[model samples]
Target: MKTNIKILALFLICSISAFAQSSKDAETVLQLSKDKWQWMADKNVDKLKDLFDAKAKFVHMSGTWKTDEELEIIKTGSIWYKEAKVHDSAIEVSGKTAIVWNRITLIAMVRGNEAKTEFTVTEVYQKQKKDWKMLALTFSSVRDTHQIKK
Candidate 1:
């Protein structure tokens, strides 16, 4: 009976260690979501592309999710963002995958008109080759725009 108890205790310790490792990996993947906002704020599309998987699908505020090819086209339009921030409201880490739900606040200019918008954004990332790559992203507008006097 003593030997059996020892084996059981060893098994429990191994299981808990595995769980902890998985949780850490998941949290690391989720951090990539925040890096995306910094990339956009910098208006360097190249950085965004580096983080994105080649097969990434990005859904715009227009209600249409574009494939990688389409997203690349949009990136070419010259993004000029004045302000962008991501508030990490919740983060859940699972093994080999992570889902980040956050609020994205941004001020941008389209045709020289300041556009301020908030969105509830969810981003999924995968671990590949020791790096986290954004696999998918979807967002919907949360709050409407209010004019800022110049």
Candidate 2:
């Protein structure tokens, strides 16, 4: 019937719209990941605290820490990020979960020692009540590909 055909067409349109919306959301999450790095570099613990989930876990070359502990470290400048240069990044979203990957060159002060290193960072964020909060983060050291040729 023509009515049945019309209903099917409308359903297809709605499905496509939903898919586009999800794609847009994924892009937003990727940008948020970049913003997070900027926040860390600036040592904006207040903003970082708002973005991190209460049950979040952070892992680095040194060790792992919970959300509150990580926030405290940032606030006190124990391991302060001075700069982060992102070399490459990607993001994927599945329902309310998003995973972001970034290859970055980071300069930071770790326990009063200035160190610069390259790392591949993975961040997992979950959508919580219309906002995305970071749930977990892990980083692995990488070779510096950003070195200038003399």
Candidate 3:
């Protein structure tokens, strides 16, 4: 009976430790996603390049493109991401992949014109060699009142 109790206690401790680690990973990915928005607004392609996977894809209302094209657009100010005011966000982490959904008011300069729009942005990130790389980003136009279900 005592041995059984010891085994149960050990199992619970291990389970709790795993949960804590998962929570920490989720928070880290969440912060990375938020930083990405700021990097886009600042046009910090250096940081973005490191964060984006080589085969990363981006989907915008205007069109869809790959990593190099997206970086070029940002570098040339073709579509300057001025600001993203995130209203709500949720993240799910499964194994090495994390998906984040953010509802935001994005102010951008597109083709020399300023536009503000509400969108739900979905970002997918994968852990590779101790670093998280953004694999995909998709923007969907939505109403201001749209909420991200937790």
Judged by lDDT, which candidate is best?
Answer: 3
Off by over 4 Å in 2: 1-4, 145-150
What order do candidates take by lDDT, descending?
3, 2, 1
Worst 10 residues of 1 by lDDT: 141-150
**Clashes per model (N, Cα, C within 3 A):** 0, 0, 0
The model with the greater lDDT, 1 or 2, is 2
Q: How accurate locally, in lDDT, is each candidate?
A: 0.68, 0.89, 0.95
Which structure among the candidates has the greatest TM-score?
3
Residue pairs in clash, model 3: none
Candidate 3's C-alpha lDDT? 0.95
List the candidates' TM-scores in order. 0.76, 0.88, 0.95
RMSD per candidate (Å) reads: 5.9, 4.3, 1.1
Report how far off residue 45 is in candidate 3 (Å). 0.5
- Give per-residue CA lDDT, model 2, range 45-116, as digits (tens): 888988999999999998999999999998889999888888888787888999888888889999999999
Which whole-number lDDT from 0 to 100 does residue 138 have in model 3?
Answer: 99
Q: What lDDT is obtained when candidate 2 is compared to the true structure?
A: 0.89
lDDT of 3 by residue, 66-121 (tens): 99999999989999999999999999888889999999999999999999999999
